[model samples]
Target chain A: MSAPAPKALLFDVFGTLTDWRGGVARAVAAAFAARGAAVDAHAFADAWRGEYQPAMERVRSGARPYAQLDELHRENLDRTLARMGFEGLFDEDERDALARAWERLPPWPDAPGALERLRAIALTAACSNGSVGLMARLARHAGLRWDCILGADLARDYKPRAGVYLAACAALRLRPEETAMVACHDHDLAAARAAGLRAAWIARPLEHGPGRPAPEPEQEWDWIARDLHDLADQLGAPRP
Target chain B: MSAPAPKALLFDVFGTLTDWRGGVARAVAAAFAARGAAVDAHAFADAWRGEYQPAMERVRSGARPYAQLDELHRENLDRTLARMGFEGLFDEDERDALARAWERLPPWPDAPGALERLRAIALTAACSNGSVGLMARLARHAGLRWDCILGADLARDYKPRAGVYLAACAALRLRPEETAMVACHDHDLAAARAAGLRAAWIARPLEHGPGRPAPEPEQEWDWIARDLHDLADQLGAPRP
Candidate 1:
């Protein structure tokens, strides 16, 4: 039987839509070339991705007040760049460019058309820890077709927090049941379901690399799909 | 010479974009007709709109905790429905529909194409206090092409606070200088400029209705457009 229709779908940005690992690697590769060095962009990408959680935990646990992802990403990038021996390769301008690459990540092959289809039905928006500015370019660059973008900054807290999910519903003028939170991460869906939003999982099996632990799907997600397009069909959105 | 383009455009939704004043009155007229009463929707719309600011200011200044526009609108709607002698005209269903009238607001005649054209050259988004869901519907209903939505909840504070404008810039990932905040209200633009965003004004001459203090486009806006279309032309956005 079909699930009840949602008023909106809030998608996770990093792995569910765009291939964050590959996207970050591509940008890292470009930066390396600009510096006349040949660094392992994949390893570099992995290193940056590795920092994702501990950074937020610092804020989540009240160890730090909220800081925007832009600043957090910059701190990690600065540290990683030095470790990678790309010494003095970036001045302020180059650093900003590398930072902006987050805004232009490529989407998964299935991302854009599915989003277009979803928008034709429920309102489609991004609900992610990525600051709004970062997510908007990623959508525009890869044609992800979000109807709106909701950033972590919206709630002043990161996902897994009930307030974050509720704030999204509050903004959309939707009750929790009227909204579906779609993400590849199990923790995200768990928190969403806890907050009363229906949940959908779009597995990006390659998010961490071929063998490393990929963020898994939640068993309680209302629907599951191989990617955004599959989830779009399950949601009964028109195929693009 | 043109003032350097402001980084973003803020909006005054009710009369500025959607003719809430007209539409609500008309919607209420239908709601009243269902009750066999001769309700002046225009007057009702005016009275309801009049109650908006002071209610918001009550929350803004901390006399009350922050409440969504949906809540504030509904509270005012309740008071006015009784005052209009339209008692027992609404139950939960009717009240829900009436509150959602804000979402179905029709755009100004000049709004849609102007925004589409503006998007071609500049990073355009909505900076309004509407709930994310309300703005989503407003944009959908009005064919507004905002790239990302910057609402009050994004900052956890309402307009006129530097935090609100600062949060919007942080979301767009643009410096306050690079982003322009556009709106029809003098106070909205003034707050944005004070918080570091460049400012543009579109005169909403009929905002408060005929001869109602004749609210003028008298602010020191860096770029004064007759409307969004004029602003698009001024910004060199490719005409759609």
Candidate 2:
């Protein structure tokens, strides 16, 4: 019985607003130290984000039709460089600039000032499976000021697929209970509350990096909080 | 030649950054002065913007399928209130709040400081036929700070269609000559330069309000400029 304060929120970029395993383990340790290789750059950024949900479960099981989380992060960076053995050590324009290291992820030091104070209290976006040109170049390289830029190429698919949370609340005409779905993941707020929407969460304890173990909320989420500047101070917003 | 400086620009919201004929003639003179009646609100905002391109040429001649320019401005505001006779004087919730007066139009005094210095040079959006919830409530009621919000509800259709300027440069993945449309209408920069993109224009000499002449550029448009703060000082964009 929670959702009464949403006009829009959406979000969930990478690990809920940047820090994709510390910017793809600092571009996989500067593309394996420009080739004089060493290895374990956060275990190759957890083997390219564990091949991101089995490549969006091959386009959510229809077995691929919708290609683009930047071509499934450049075909899951050639199977995370052939499952970490590092096959043919980078070419095709250095694996297209290491598949744009998830478009240069870096926010999360309070995710760009709590997304400029939760965008003055409402309508924010990037409902990410990433790729409206990788969330418009990761929201201009992580300053993250979205008012538009909905997810998975306007819901062709992906996300705990409720048509990507009802196509980011029908591209803003809203009303999936007037939108909410922020996330740090409780299976993406139980698939955005089974698609009727309204959820919040937050808590990205260094999003699988610093010391690891950061998984907490497993159940009820209408508004949890801790990181996005305490969900923009529990949604009141003012203090930018 | 003039295709070099763009990374993204797009734009074209109702008479290039708002003024929808003086904000839909001050919302059709306050809804016919709350019905005491005193019409001719700028000729009913030019007969509801002259039924906007024959209601997007019935969804670009397929004879209608795609809709949402807020349902063709609520069916052209009931044919601009029965061609100004005021048919049954405003009902369906005051014609759904006068078809949201194009979502509270009003920008254009150098459109929110030249779109905050052309979003600090480049990536700005709203390739407008309007409706991502009426350009996200007319960019939060006209402060207009878009980084994303592509046109014709993600190019379902409308605008001097070239699939609505190549579906807003293929939804930010760009490369319609790296994008650049801007507008004040030289046939919407000649259909965003016949869809290969790159154009600029921006004049808006009080956009059909003052002495009413306004539109000048009939051809050559790579960067014209005069209004969006001289196209953010010819795109160098520093002085806000």
For lDDT, the strongest prediction is 2
Candidate 1 yields a Cα-based lDDT of: 0.80
The local distance difference test score of each candidate is 0.80, 0.83
For candidate 1, the per-residue lDDT at A84 reads 75
lDDT tens readout by residue for model 1, A162-223: 88888888888779999999888888898899899999988888877788665555485788
Among all candidates shown, the one with the greatest DockQ:
1
Can you write out model 2's per-residue Cα lDDT over B1-240, one digit (the tens) per residue? 244689888888888888898898998799889888888788788888888889888888989898778888788889878876888988899888888888998988778888888888787888888778778878888888867888777767888888877867776787888888888888878878887888998888887778766668998888898888877777788993
TM-scores for chain A over all candidates: 0.92, 0.35
TM-score of chain A of 1: 0.92
Question: lDDT (0-100) at residue A117 of candidate 2?
Answer: 85
With candidate 1 superimposed using the best TM-score fit, by how many Å does residue B214's alpha carbon deviate from the native? 6.5
lDDT of candidate 1 over B71-181, digit per residue (tens) = 889999988888877668789788878877888877889888887777666667777787677788888887888788885777766888788888888777778888887
lDDT of 1 at B31: 81
Tens-digit lDDT track of model 2 for A68-138? 78877788888888877888998889998888988888988778888878878788888888767678777
